[model samples]
Target: MTTNTRAWRWGQLLALTLGALSSLHCVELPTKSYSCSSAEDCQGLSGPGGVSYVCGSGGWCEAPAGSACPQASTPPTCSTSNWCWDNPLSEGRNLITVRGRSATDIWAVGERGIALHWDGTCWARILPGNSQQLRAAWPAAGQTWWFAGAGGSLLTWDGANWTSQALAEQVTFHDIEGASGTSAIAVGQAGALYTFNGQQWRPQSWDAGTSPAPDLLAVWPVSNTEAWAVGRNGTVVRGVDGGWSRVSNPTSVDLVAIAPGADAGTAYAVGRGVLATYANSTWTASSFATSTTPLNGVWTSAGVTRIVGPASNIFVLGSATPEPSGTSQVLNSIWGNDTSLWAVGGSGSIVRRAGGQWSEFPGGVARTINAIWGTDDRNLWAVGDQDLIMRRVDERWSPAAPPEPGAFRALWGSGDTLLAAENNPTATGGSNGKIHLFQNGQWTPSASFPSNGVNAFWGTGLAPVWAVGTGGLIRRRDEAGTWLTEGNPNTASAQFNAVWGVPNAEVWAVGAGGAIFRRDVSGSWVSQRPSGATELFGVWGTGSRDVWAVGLNGSAWRYDGTTWTQVSTGVTQTLRAIAGRSTDSVWAVGDNGTITYWNGSTWMPQVSGVSENLRAVWVTQTSVWVAGANGTVLRLPL
Candidate 1:
């Protein structure tokens, strides 16, 4: 099959920035927990806005507590000023494979063509035009490297920039291997090959005539023709001078990563705890002492072969010795405190490891911790599921006492004043998702909260507070503690997940369906919307309109007062929170323990030790704090 090198067109940068773009709309109620049971449930002044949410089994919609707050339904007002704005250059990142020769030369790759490099002291991001999912990367020489991914995407890195290339066949590029910088090859879906010369990338044609085209995932090349590729359908292929031919593989469970030993025709491939070796054209399969988990990448370093998968499965080859495995949950994010590590996942499971021993934090309530952050190990916080909030203290876990018997989904704070939000589980419970503040030790509930659940909130020291929630809930509190509400520009129900403020008046918030709102000098909220299905989750700002917001499905937006624009962060991993002590030192955390840094403009990915669901982030001049489910707490160096 002839592979075509598609020309680069002006494509959308997959990176999401703070307040990049947004739209306005009234709130709509879903039919599930946060959903609506009837049309009247969404009845605002504009009829059923679809923002109606069923308030448990009772047929009443949860309206705000107030007089003349219609028994029929209350109006869904804008709630932008009460939330965190987006990060202008904060991008979503999932560090799938972390490999390094030295501390300064580490590379991690993941979905959305994300390729991030660490240079000992700091991290940098490289974006290839293709948003195709990237799987693995191997540095061939100085700065020259090769990466493989979906859509048959192949990329080569010269000392400076990344160039997109094509494979011999249009298959998902999975793995790459070579003896040195010059003799490297990449393999992917089907028997595909693309070799790298010193200058450009070109396909290496093999005349196998596309037999069943097994889903090739990894490749290790001994010589040019004496190369091997492994994939799904128990497929293994050997490359000869004329073409690539399939060899018999024992298992069909999709080999994800592979590595060649020091000798030619000697290699190892791994998938779901199944390890196979290829020698003299025959494949021999064996099981290791390692847990039968899905292994993603394998490598042979210093004569020892190690394999890593989603749950930190580290396996050895020569002795078949197994190391302790990481938690096998589909971890959404990760964080660490001075004494604890936390990993949150599906269900309300929050796993914590303190003193090198892993355990589950007992929140009693099974709720997902979507975001986490705090000042220190003893002052950590995590927010998620049904408005859940968990806190850590001296390595002990405690439920961050709920504001009400409601769900607290997002959180933010500065100093002793803390602001938390509630996404009303049922819209009919007269709990329009209130914003609660922990000042000193009292849980003070604010008036005029959200007409629905509050997704995220940000606060300065204590004097004034900003909170945003479901249904464009934009409410602000001035020095006098009076709640001011604003109307959204759009009629659709947009859920703002995050909010941030520079001062009492200069504030911003971001939300679902690409909705963004900004507060002017006069302390009034204005609506902004970007196009697409981008759902903004977390927001932070240096000033009034200069803010950033991140959200579901890896969407990020940036606000610059006059307009909102999107920036590329390479990875499409869902980002949950944004925090920066200074303009050049911003930190964002999210699902899969994604940690992306913003050097003022562009967002770069960083390694956050753990891969659990990180819920929130707080950064000071010299310290960074992240919190997550399972009592996960993390503190970073300045």
Candidate 2:
């Protein structure tokens, strides 16, 4: 076809797809074809929204570049103090190890080459070019730092730029400790050990008495002549007389971290539910009366000792028991001065214990958000596993109580009245589906259904609510606040996943095995199965005639007041939820940080910058909110 003719046809197609003629003139097309064999050939071609065109599989330039959405130039404004992407006061990345010269100069390292520095007030991120997970970090002499991590990543920061070092062998480095300006010891997986002596890093060999070496995880250097290293399978080695010798390991747990104790000739080691102390050349098992969580890092200073572990656990010796931290994220590393202590862990969790009370910071709750609902952007509710419910008020997310303890599957509501569907297991080895209501700042048990599980919820308000679940179960709440079971209409038993509707009794529910049902004015659901047997997980629409459903294997279907037609999403990730503000602008999120946007005609993928599974999405006129596994919460302005 001629270039002008094709452009005209494309404009017409977009106009028809959006059901509007006003947007027809905005469909800018290239006058000449860009020659390309792959998508890279079309790079830098100007398109809408400062985006570049990409070469499609058909060798044509497609609108919207394959880059992440543009970062906000300014941080979001909120009435209350909250953590946003641009204002990164709190850590949102998993931290593995922490070290510092003093309280004013602290460093924490973690996955994705994350390095954070604390300047006595707040934390700031330092980007190391490599994306490898940094497992260990230590301070050297005078503003110099050393970092070792996965894939043989050994980096040195000379108070300015980070430089990578070449090593003899390519292996992951777990721990590094500096004894002096010219000497340091590092250990890693599979018994790999190396020492840095001013000029270069050289491999160190140890004599194993006919036993396979275990993976070393941590190293602590007391002096040039005395150092200790701990590893998997209860391996503990001490350095003396310029040589390493095996020390008695008291526990079989894989020792992850070691630290000096309160006094001389005393050290502590902790790992997988085991804590051990070495005193006067003898090892003894130590125990904590309160916790058994797998410990990761230990630190001691000013006659005080602290141990941190999974589930936000921090045990302080010689201190009274404080309140529970109330966070579920695993604590990976800890550091402190005499008066204050800080712990970091999975999902960007950072907590501080000061004045004998543990208080959580604003960043890093890595719990998967299964469902999100709100009256608007500021007033929102998100539900997830372990009875986790969060409320976003004035842009900050805080914990909210659920009616009971169970994983929530879906949430929907209007002003002042919200409902959550939960699948609570019964004592008889079966499931009990319950609907919890939130109103007036409290959560209460509202209703229960006979279904084994409740998966999705939809409602115009509190009066007429619909819930779908396993085995083709459907239930509804009428205006009289009474719950009633609407029998399954599908011929086959399909697990319903999501439901959405508009006014006038037009509701659509989609589920596994390609099951699609719609409720009529008579309150009876009728099957509306489309071709193919793909399991659908999410459904939403701007109106009755404009609806979309997404499912497994990148399958998507759209309804335009007629038969449902399949829409092609280039990737095959399992999409879990979809939301939008208008017919021409919609989004769908799924596993492995997949986010696809429907720009009126085609579904284009957008980079989320995370590898966690996204489970739910909520949209407002000017913003989009997505929640997913590992306490991940993302927001973007429309």
Candidate 3:
């Protein structure tokens, strides 16, 4: 018999047994027959093998013996109200460098040979037919462009078509600069530098005697005869009289980028926490005020200088303070015209600076999504690594202000009240847990909790919220907004990964080594370790008697009042989260974008187009939402 047929047979046997037990115990049982408008409504029911029930042609639930279960044959459709994958335009690809002649005409290149263009209104990806990472791009007069990257890949765009140019060896090209389309230079690993003479590229030899060759990172062409290249270990080279010569070094930090200043013979080079200026043929180094963030890109136009780096730091020359772009994304390249400035970085981060303020643009790129919660279909929040938080409003996702500078692991709330659990890092390379309350459109630190990392939260949005985390830690938030430490049943410490509760009094926490705890009527946590030693990551239930927990090694357990039984999931991948509309209908998501459904008697896998690790799952009566690594948000019909 087929899988569905076997499942149906088991269900029928179970239903018959339950029916008999209900009569003996004076309990109620659902009738075997059901009315339905669609197959989904008729699913999760009990029947005999090869006699599974489905929605008939007349729209009523009926058994069609020996028929196969319906299969998901096509890709799930994404809609504002239905299933969809919401991510940035880069599709989780990191954009390394961006260049544009104007705000309307822009091009960005990054890993996997991804190329994107902006035509004043929207961005579109252009296929380059390669997957190697593209490291640098330079736009030369009118539609002509140059892209260089890994494996010695060099591509030239001539307004209409892109053609690859061969090189002698595979080497990464870091940056490109040009005085004109014909007179340009590129720099890369191990002292690699090349010059383009309008027709072909030629390698330039630099003499360094017996010293090691420096990896050139950036080049700035003030003129064909006078250009500068900066690289590792403070190696600086000046191109003069048609040859390259070593220049005096100011600091040993690896210089990443160079830009010309307002006057001739004046320029600025920045790298790692050090900013250097070259004037009168001498370079001088100075520390950026109160900034330890490594600098990546520098630009100067009309004497207005801007430097961009990690943590969205933007330092303008002559300004007393550094302006924060309000994002924690690492900016790789910065460029713009007189009216606007753009920076691209890790996690599909793209921000624009105009009117003396920086604003982020929605790219739908995937970043790691660690936790997700929502009050309704539209008002949803997702948090992840690098202080990333996003909120959905009117079907559009936008970044929300981070509660604090740390990775958020869990969120729980209802209506306008919500709480977030964060792992705040310390200077000594460790982390501690903290809680933040969301109120009046902002997130603020809540009462102090334990120092251990908080991993999960569950409550009714009222007083007495429960949080579980490292070291078997359990804390409760009372109605008076004070956090009180609660003792767990386990004398030995265990890491708690997830928590779910029916109310303030009855709660369940699951974690490492198959550890499970439930709060007793006496307000004490008692160990309820089920079968197996697989680490449990998520827990949820329809009621106290129908609780379910999913975890490592594809382990899933269901609690039926008195006993916990193992449910066969048939896969070994770690299952992260579980949600359900009823005990008979449930869903679980996990690593490798795995999504499995439990229909009464059997568990089956569903195809998720993505391949990232799915970390969390949430379900309602009609919809299911999943969040995963690289900001992947997927919604589907329940």
State the TM-score for model 2: 0.68
Write candidate 2's Cα lDDT for 349-467 as tens digits: 66666655554443334455688876445345678876666554223354444566688888876544567888877787666788887554445687776546888888766768888
Give Cα-based local distance difference scores for all models: 0.54, 0.70, 0.72
Model 3, residue 543: displacement in angstroms?
Answer: 5.1
Report clashes for each candidate as comma-separated counts.
Answer: 97, 8, 12
- RMSD of each candidate relative to the true structure: 21.2, 14.2, 14.5
Where does the lowest 10-residue lDDT sum fall in candidate 1? 1-10
User: In model 3, what is the error at residue 378, expressed in angstroms?
Assistant: 6.2
TM-score of each: 0.42, 0.68, 0.66
Name the top lDDT candidate.
3
Candidate 1 residue-wise lDDT, 235-287, digit = tens: 77777663666666677677766677656657888777588887776788876
The total of clashing pairs for model 1 equals 97
Best-to-worst TM-score order = 2, 3, 1
lDDT of 1: 0.54
